[model samples]
Target: MRTLPPRIQNLTNKVSAVFVPLTVLLALSAFAWVLVIDNDLPAAIFRGLTVALIACPCALGLAAPLATWMTAHRLASRGIIIRSGDALENGGTVRHLYLDKTGTLTSGRFKIESVTTIDETLENPLALAAGLEQASTHPIGDAIRAAADEATTFDEIEPVPGLGVRGSLAGDTYALGRPDFPGQQPLPADTMTPNSRDKTHTIVLWRNEQPVALFGLVEEERPDTEAALNTLRRLGLNLHVLTGDASTQAAAFAQRYHLPVSTALMPDDKRQIIVDRRRETHKPIGFVGDGINDAPALSEADLGIAVHTGSDLAQASGDVILLTDGIAPLSDLFRAARETRRRIYTSLIWAFAYNAVGLTLACMGILSPAYAAIAMIGSSLIIIWNSTRGGSLWLRDEHQLTEEDPPTRSTNLTA
Candidate 1:
């Protein structure tokens, strides 16, 4: 089960697909024998089997798939395909969403959001920082290179395993890394700390063997972040961001989105957070992630929502999957979930009502096998028809699925 594909997979589903029909076929044959035993009529055999043929819960079978397919088709018009339905169903009940910051919220590209010098060297920080960062392969380094407006040249470059890149510029040696030194020394509470900066760090710089300046750099929140957070808040969701990024960076994102922040999280650390939160509150938690790194957290969440625009591992692990990548698209999903739930409830009621009515007629000897067959078909058709409303539930798609391949499944299936 763990290794199975995300979509309908395995002996269970395949066997279940056929087993229902075969069982019905066999039951009809047995029923025909019973009718013979009672010497009622040969017509009952035809009616029961015909009912099995016509009313074999095909509508019930088609309900989810039809909804899925129609939803997928509807989403495709907006450049998305939903290859998973159970994931969506699970995500709807999410009262809390734990998001992976790096690729899920932030673009995973670092640019110097804003630069402030810890000392008094703000003027040439961009050029000098870019020169040092040009030697490293870290995401922050790449972001530094991209954000530097001024071009810089570097001399002898040395890569420190945990600290940062050390390079020379104009006969000066510099190290750029996290300000809270990596096991070397800890900064005091007021060691030229950056204020009003939350949730991220840029390249901490030491120029000429002394800490001349610190780069108050961090990841930027998407413009949509403000709106998404507001929507979640309005929906009474306590959104939290979990990340391996600096505590400061996570704080910044949390500030912008109004999400509570937990930072310095490893993959397992994230899983632990979800576990702790679930154990403490027992509220349904949803996770939104786009990286393979998010697989653990996504798996831990009750409603694992992986944007299809993300890694395949995320999609594979998530319970509720968003085919569209926009935060705005979540509103559409909210609507669809409510709609699907409503339809399921409605279908359940109809099933009960229809069964009750048909049973009454059967007990009264008024509903022959033919009438039971018709009633059964009617019962499921109502469910299928009701569920289709999920397709019309619309929001916007950010159209983020161009890079990732959609998981394959039977295209003929719906819902």
Candidate 2:
């Protein structure tokens, strides 16, 4: 794989560039000092050459990129696709995480519990709702489409980010989305009932700017949801849920997970909240989501993490994509990022230490140029081994392979 570096790696390169010329100047100074002190031309030149050879920047250059490369490889094997090394570093620094409600915290597999329609003349309004929602990427839309027998296609199908979808069918306008999306017409008192029951969501259908039908959906939390959130909390991340669900339902969900929440948010609202929080805290924030409405906030976050089942636009906006189902791998991702950084720091310290000792010995006439060259190569080898040991950032149990389990071992890489 090609070397993809984070900002720290770029900074390392700049430091290495400056060190090269600085080391050359120091080597020249050592040469002149030796010649003046001992009046020995051969000894002065040898000492200068030893200093330069010992201070070669190979190890310094390898320190950052090698560690990142190893970490990225490990992440890929574990079904996490990071777009760049920057995501790995950013993931480590995230102090807060904003998660979307549907398809993210809850299982996206929605079941159509009830489909009611006020239009007495219309037959099979469920099919009509499904037809309009067929083009939608939302979990609710997927459920509608899955439950319908056949969907009638529409002309000019358009999806409004946080609201719902709209299209023209048979020269009449049709919309299937949030209740307030289609028109100002009041919904039936029963259809507008508060979603007091657990795990229930609602969607409204409109025909020619009039409410026609309401669909009730039930989505259960993923089995791994509790474990994933617990792991994140243990890692010191302040969790928040930003969702378009009704306030009551949102509050209930938030209370269950013990997370702060913002309910009834549009895509723009979600994005603006992230922007405002960034200005207030000045700390890195992460957003995890898997829907069309989530694209805006995902793009606005310090790190955008999308699931494999999310819309194409969402995946494009994400810096990191979780290829596996459930967010259990999320904790492992942060852990790997921290470990990668640790390895890089360890490698750099060893590199600098090698040069410090070698330069001191060379100036004292105790180390020869041949020994200096060998020491330089040895330093680089040590860094390589440290960065790529066991070909993983963390180890996992071999006996269990499940969504809730930590990362497992994979093919090893050669240092």
Question: Tell me, what's the RMSD of every candidate?
Answer: 9.3, 6.3
RMSD value for candidate 1? 9.3
Q: Provide the overall lDDT of each model, using Cα atoms, as 2-decimal numbers.
A: 0.59, 0.81
Candidate 2 clashing pairs? none
Q: How does candidate 1 score on lDDT?
A: 0.59
**Model 1: runs farther than 4 Å from truth?**
1-55, 79-85, 101-110, 113-139, 147-176, 187-191, 194-202, 205-213, 244-257, 281-284, 290-295, 306-326, 348-365, 368-377, 393-415
Q: How many clashes does the backbone of model 2 have?
A: 0
The true-versus-predicted C-alpha distance at residue 399 of model 1, in Å, is: 22
lDDT of 2 by residue, 134-238 (tens): 767788888899999988877768888788888898899988887768363758677676533666777888888888888888886798798777777666567
lDDT string, candidate 1, 9-47, tens digits: 232356347757764665466457658766666656654
Residue range with the least summed lDDT across 10 consecutive positions in model 2? 406-415
